[model samples]
Target chain A: MTRMIGAGRRAIAALLLLSLAACGAQPRSVPPPAFNSTDVMFLQMSLEYIRQGEQVLTTAQTRAKNAELKTLTAALQAQWAEEQGTMQRWLLGWSQPLTADPSSGAHEGHGDLHSLRPSDIAELQATKDNFDGTAEALLLGHLHNCVEVSRMESTGGQYPPAKALAEQMAATRQGQVQRLLKLQTGSTMGA
Target chain B: MRRRIALALLSIAAVVASMFVAIAPASAHGYISSPPSRQANCASGKVANCGDIVWEPQSVEAAKGSKLCNGGGSRFAVLNDASKGWPAASVGRTVTFNWVFTARHATATWEYFIGNTLLASFNDGGAQPGATKSHTVSMGSFTGRQTVLARWNVADTANAFYSCVDVTIS
Candidate 1:
């Protein structure tokens, strides 16, 4: 009986190993047409960008000196949050991994959070004056980056859903950029 | 004994399967190379102390209008500092901008800016760009040392990669 139990344990271990090996085996003999690394990179980066934008806008919503700036940040925060949800859903539906291996060196050339670094965020939080101006500048930079990346995905991305999302983002953000520029110049009366 | 052998074979198969999962996926993207953008210079070792950008020259990214050196990260912020004396490329009134792409994407436009003024704009529409493309841009009545901010805008996505070229107009 003791010997039989030991054998069963070994069998379980072996089964586990085999299952792992099976997973390692090519899931298909031929590669399926699906999301490649660029697609993945675009999706991942887009999500990150939106999340970062949300963070900055949230800060702006409360601290912005200008009522227009506060209103704009609140609207932007909602927009980005919705977009973030869409990206996450696509990532899930496509079965594409959400995060890239940072060590894999795959994320090298991709643009990331340049507009609002942690220090910049801290500074914005610390300063009671010129909060609106700083928020406007950061948000403008953020929107511009979004437009560029969305354009890339719309043109270059393989996945159709991602491409569509990119297109939508570009158009929406471009409009936002125009609005932001108007606000920056204190020309919010017409907008 | 037979069960043990079967188990051992299964383990081997699992190990092999795991190996396949461990393999990295193919990478594709685009970046400017000619006249060497800051990221390109760092990747090619033309610039020293480049930080993370040296590995992925194509990844110099940030908010579209953000005036950042290393795309936005502090690690590559050295590219943002103008006083670092980045080497300037000598060119005529019209110069060709070369783009190296790992994967082709639908393009919106290519914009070149000097300070707040736009120097050139090329409309690509939504056509998929080739792996390599060159555009001859008129420097637009500017002479002397100028920094050209070249932006490649993708049609579908909401971001653009930026490259700053230090050029001496002849």
Candidate 2:
């Protein structure tokens, strides 16, 4: 009977060992951070463009003559400000820097930077004539860039929450583009 | 009597240990849940006598190129059992399978198959996907009860996840 108890203890130890083996196979407890380069790049690019957009929206908010355009700018400022906060929080959680790396050349090249650029914001800031037209064009270009970054994130981003946000942003920006087109009467809004 | 008690105690300890192992974390895991795949049903208790897979429904992972529902993993081998007569969800010609992911991994391609015939495939071009993705697949002339095996090929890894949804198409 004593020997039988010894065998029982061995069986229990073996089971415990098996359980430990299974535990070893499990994903680590330190947290699984699965994010690709696209996820990081999208957040960085979006933050840069949205930061530039803040100034453009502020200009539109104060200087616009068109009533509907004023209302649109107000809406965009609030929405983008909230989205900016969200992206910043996510970037912090991912341990990514909020500022874009100028050395990466990701924001370089005419094709990549065509939609939103610092010069575009300056062009809007310095424009003395047709402020609304310049703002409209800049905002249109900014919106297009937002949609493009959103598409990139939705397709190539690994994080679920980030991808979900990207998809939502894409849909929202597309709708806003349509609205802006209706408000734009000049050739700049024709696209 | 003491021997019997010891044996019973050992069995109890084993059951408790197994239970603890079942709830461990699974990263980058996903499974199609709309039509209730074999593992989903097991997890939901809609089906019984299913081994191991009822614990981690999102972990039916194995190497790529397996035609089986569980991707040929022995841990989820019960999923490949055709004699279990898994329940089929009734759907239309254009059935959209909603893939509910616990964690979304970077993906290469999403493919669906009915037996030897390939139903449809979507190329992700080595991109990461969202938590819950949906694909609308046209069954075309195929009708009656069939098991649609969906495979997600991970871009970074050689492994892929498998989910077998039994659907009754009209």
Candidate 3:
């Protein structure tokens, strides 16, 4: 009995020491790595569409062609008006002209309303197309990431806005993938 | 043995709890770190610093000529951060007032007023060129929206210069 007690004590001491060692090791404390790269890609893609729309508006304004201007204006304006609501909610808690800065590098989620110059218009269009493609790619990528983020992880303690935004992006991007593909196809045929 | 188990579990729980608590505030939405530029003078042939003027009706509905604020006889406008009514209507209230005023003149003493009411008077003794002061009042005294007035009745008008007034009502 004495020998058994000594062995048990030794085992417990070893277990306790192991636990302490584990505790002492620095936790990797990883920041929830922001939404998967695809979410980021989609956001960037959305932002590009906004920029492209602006370029199209600027072109119409410069050309001063009434019919073309009206069509471009209506389409660009309609899309932007809808996006404004989304961006506002994403920026200010309630929307309505209030502007809040997203994190430093996370501005892929905001709108660009600053004035533009004629010289930069061409480059802006190119960027817009690039972004449009990227946004589509992100939509293609979202299904895999969404399952991992929503189903794999415990949502019990996730940040409300972050989680809500992820869900929104997931739904919106899927719809956008279909619409944007048609738009892209149409635009190519017209070109 | 049971006591030791409980203590060990308690320590582990405490560490995890503290770790989560420490990370939360950092993850909250970020805030604007700097204020917009402050206007130095309003009357230098410059259009009223479009950035400085703050009015609520924002549209045509700003209580139809409500007294926004008196800049002690200077020009004043609302600082975006200074607007009131959070978690409620931003421009729906019928009575809310706040003002920040700056003095452009040096003087021994000066009095500020808003329609028969004394807001703040200062005796600068030897105060500098641009003395600034702020006063706030609840609009419970006034009934309907009226053209609220503010003035800087200076002890020495020669030395007194004014900025602008920014007032918010409702």
Point out where model 1 deviates above 4 Å.
A1-33, A105-115, A187-191, B1-170
What is the lDDT for A174 in model 3? 33
Q: Which docking category, incorrect, acceptable, medium or high, applies to candidate 3? A: incorrect
Best by DockQ: 1
Residues A1-191 of candidate 3: C-alpha lDDT, one tens digit per residue: 99999999999999999988776563437432322222222333344345534554554444432343245345545655675456445433311112112332222211221112232345334443333322222222222222222221224323355456546544443343234333322332232
What is the DockQ score of candidate 1, to 2 decimals? Answer: 0.03
- Point out the higher-scoring one by lDDT: 1 or 3: 1
By DockQ: ranked, best first: 1, 2, 3
- Whole-model Cα lDDT of every candidate shown, in order: 0.63, 0.70, 0.32
Which model scores highest in lDDT?
2
Chain A TM-score of model 1 versus the true structure?
Answer: 0.72
Q: Please name the candidate that would achieve the greatest TM-score relative to the true structure.
A: 1
Clashes of 1: 41
